[model samples]
Target: MRTIEVFADVLCPFTHVGLRTLVDRRGRYGLTEPRLRIRAWPLELINDGPLDPHHIAAEIAALRGSVRPDLFAGFSVDAFPGTSMAAFALTAAADRTGDPALVEDVGMALRNAVFEEGLDIGRPEIVEPIAVRFGLEPLDVEATSAAVRADWEEGRTRGVIGSPHFFAEDGSGWFCPSLAISRDDVGNFVVAWKHGTEAFIDRVFG
Candidate 1:
């Protein structure tokens, strides 16, 4: 089994796009089974001052019409809360449960709440319902919040200063969302493990 550590900020449009792309291709990429893990590494989208949700939403809207634009176009960014706080919240969520999938779900839900449903994720009360929807216990909110703060500090120590960073099991990492890995470079390495491993390897590494 190989794990892909995805260091991303929920407030980042590129992270949203990259995640949607990965989710869309998960099965096609032969990562639909237990052999793959998607871990989150928190990153801050805004600094110094409060982020305007409306402006962020508009930027997300502009990203629509590009490849997979519909993945985020219909959302209203203005309805969501600030970016920095949301990132903190997600980190807290991941820490409380120790479930990477839950962390990813929380991140996705936060994005949807802010961009698609025009909800405020920065508010603990607002984010609680979404967390419940993912089967997380509402009481865990406090733990999740604390985790966010700790993760932020850890992220900085790791030199992760941006969103959509990829850390592969082989120690290969990518900081840019636009990075594309050639199969030949790590052909013998397992990209995914499933019934279609042979075919996936052939298509990617052949």
Candidate 2:
């Protein structure tokens, strides 16, 4: 199987939608050569601080009210993770198993716990069960952290524009392809389908 690497933050609302779209539409296109390799793009490391829950809550509100009413229905600001590094490391550990399905499944499960189940994935209590269910071994913390940092560095070299940046092994790339983000006149964020997005999705799964 070909690999399509996606560098994304686990807690990003946008990444949640982008990954969900990929999983939801993959079968529709009747193609599956490119298995998604979910990589880490921890915004906290890039920004040098934990993301503000209030800011994320605002984005979730806009996303839910605009184009994704069916998603994030259980989001809770209080349950938001304080840091995504550990979660990223968890996904990185999954990637190390050399199973694309496990990597993708673990990444999506982490996001689902956060966005739909109102779980604090930063906590072991929340993330551990998901790892165990996927048959993941105990994570090698040092190795996983290094893997995540390597992905961040690679994303920088590849010029990842933001979370959910997809890079095909063939060298084609797209950033946040699932939705178009814009601001309303009053400065509230609005989202819509990007023009020509379906063609790209076809290319991805086809």
Candidate 3:
């Protein structure tokens, strides 16, 4: 099976755009079946603390406006999650259910909840509501929690340093990919991809 491995932090806005780009281009890239596998890349764990949401609001808002204007308008400037471990665990737990589509859906829902809907996805309550929206039942928190830890360790060994990282089937990788993101001087937000989606599709599935 052809696969693309992705490591992303739900709290990271670039991850939001990158995942969106992948989904938007999935059909065009002929990405059927288990063509992509997404895992949690916990930025908080790597940095030993939560990132400053205030620092990246402008950048996130700009990209959100371009990608999904309605959702962007709903993004909050005051609310921010302390950690996305619960959210990450949800994705891993979804993957464990042997359903790639569910994993993918969970990832998208979790991201949107935090970044777009201004929901606190770091908690189980918020996640459960989102999960229900996706027609999924509650995942085993303990098991999924362990899965997130494992994913973080694996990513560390692989030299992953940030969120929105992608690894191709051939082991080629990228961080916060272009056309997929933008950042400030401190890596808050600059601008993401406007046209590099096809190039990425070619590299991954061409």
Candidate 4:
């Protein structure tokens, strides 16, 4: 069993795309169980101050157009809020729950809240309902808030460059889902490991 550490920021559409792709390839990627360990790294979408709603909408539109045009097509960017607060909140939630699945769920819900429902995620009041939807306790939300803030500060100190960063046990790193090997590649590796000694050597070393 290999441990894969996933670093992601909730505010990033690329993160969302990466997660969706991973979910779609779970079994194929040998993640059928709880083998993958995801670590949320909060990132700031707006640096100086509050982001303009219009600008956020435009960025969302551009991101959708470039990456997931079909899912975001005809979708109103104005409805979705920016990612900063939500990402932090999720980090907080993960800290308290001890259940990483909760983090994944909340992250997905947060993205849907913005991209699909067009809700403002920056406000705590708006995010509360999403938390409830996940059956999280009120204290959990509060704890998540604190955790996210601390994590954000810590992430900066750790030199976290961006979201969707992946680290493998072998010291290999990947920055995006696009960098992930194909399902066939994973399968071949598994097959070589199980059956062919030379094939396994070639696959792993070459």
Candidate 5:
């Protein structure tokens, strides 16, 4: 099985879209049971807390509708947390269980909570119940905190500078993949489906 590490922030919409595209189009890319590891690159930690993603209106508007048209007509992010530390901790704990499906399931749920439902995922109240539903034990805050940091530092070592970063089993990496953000002639936000995405998958599982 091929192993791939995907670094993303829980509150990042681009990460959500990129991940969704990869999962939804896995067969099109010929990926068969590729081991996907979700790593935390918590934006608040790296950028310091108190930064909301809705501040970047253009980028958000460009991708949100294109990624999931059924969700909404345009982008208007609701309230979210200042920090994603707590969310990252829970995700790290899920990863510690050494179950890829568990990590993906739990991680995606967390992402949905923040991006779609507009919940503050950085709250334990939000994560604990979900953890329980997955039959996972209470999180070891200290250990998980360290693990979260380690994931961030590892991403740094690999030059992962942003969310939605992908590292394939063959030692390849890309950031904000599966689509390209650009401006149309009218200067409106547009999402062009272009990237070296197929090559990334082929290099790993081919």
Candidate 6:
């Protein structure tokens, strides 16, 4: 199997949409060889502060109104995780376990916990069960944090500009291919499809 690495943050609504699209459409492409290897790109760490729920809420609203009304139906900004470091660590640890399915399941569940189920994933009680269900062994905190930071460093070297950056086996990459975001004159977000985005996905996975 070929691994297509994605650098993303769990709390990011945009990453949620991008990964969900890949998962939902992967089968339709009739290709299973390219498995997603989600990597840590913790936005809080990159931004030097915790993500603001209010800001995320506004982005979600724009996304719902413009692009993905079917998704994020249960999203509540109030339930957003205060920090994604631990969740990123969990995902990095999952990747370390060497099970592609476990990696995908844990990553998606973490994002769903925030965007769909409105759960505060910062709490161990909320995150631990997800790991347990997948039969994941508890990982040491320092080890997992180190793993996440390693991914961040690698992403920086590889030119990951933001969450949901995808890189194919040949090292070609795209930033947030699911949609293109821009700000309007009034400073509101405008979400639209990037031209040839579907072609790009097919090229990577087909």
Per-model TM values vs. the true structure: 0.68, 0.93, 0.80, 0.63, 0.82, 0.94
Superposition TM-score, candidate 5 onto the true structure: 0.82
Clashing pairs in model 3?
179-193, 180-193, 181-191, 181-192, 182-190, 182-191, 183-189, 183-190, 184-189
Alpha carbon lDDT of each predicted model: 0.54, 0.84, 0.72, 0.54, 0.73, 0.83
Model 5 bad stretches (over 4 Å): 27-32, 56-58, 71-78, 138-140, 182-190, 201-205
Q: Pick the candidate with the highest TM-score.
A: 6
Which candidate comes out best when scored by lDDT? 2
- Per-residue accuracy of model 3 over 1-206 as CA lDDT, tens digit each: 55678888878776777777677777666657445578878778778888787755776667765665544445676667777877776677677777667777788878777776788777878788776776666557677667777988899888777877788877888776655454558756545455666676668656
lDDT of the structure predicted as candidate 5: 0.73
Q: What is the lDDT of residue 31 in candidate 5?
A: 59
Question: Candidate 6 at residue 150, lDDT?
Answer: 89
For model 6, the run of ten residues with the poorest summed lDDT = 135-144
lDDT of 1 by residue, 1-206 (tens): 23456666666666776666556566576675222233344444236466566655554544563344466644665455554454455445454666666666676667666656666666767766776677654434465445555555666666665776655555555564442312335332111123442343333222
TM-score of 6: 0.94
Candidate 4, pairs of clashing residues:
79-118, 80-118, 92-144, 93-144
Ranking by TM-score: 6, 2, 5, 3, 1, 4
In each prediction, how many residue pairs overlap at the backbone (N, C-alpha, C within less than 3 A)? 4, 0, 9, 4, 0, 0
Off by over 4 Å in 2: 30-33, 138-141
Tell me the deviation in Å of residue 179 in model 2.
1.6
| Candidate 1 colliding pairs, count | 4
Residue 15 deviation, candidate 3, in Å?
0.7
Write the residue-wise lDDT of candidate 4 on 1-206 in tens digits.
Answer: 33455667655555666566555555455554333445656555326454455654554454554445544433355554544565456445654666656656666667666656656676768877876777764444566556665655655555556777755566555566342222244332111112332332222223
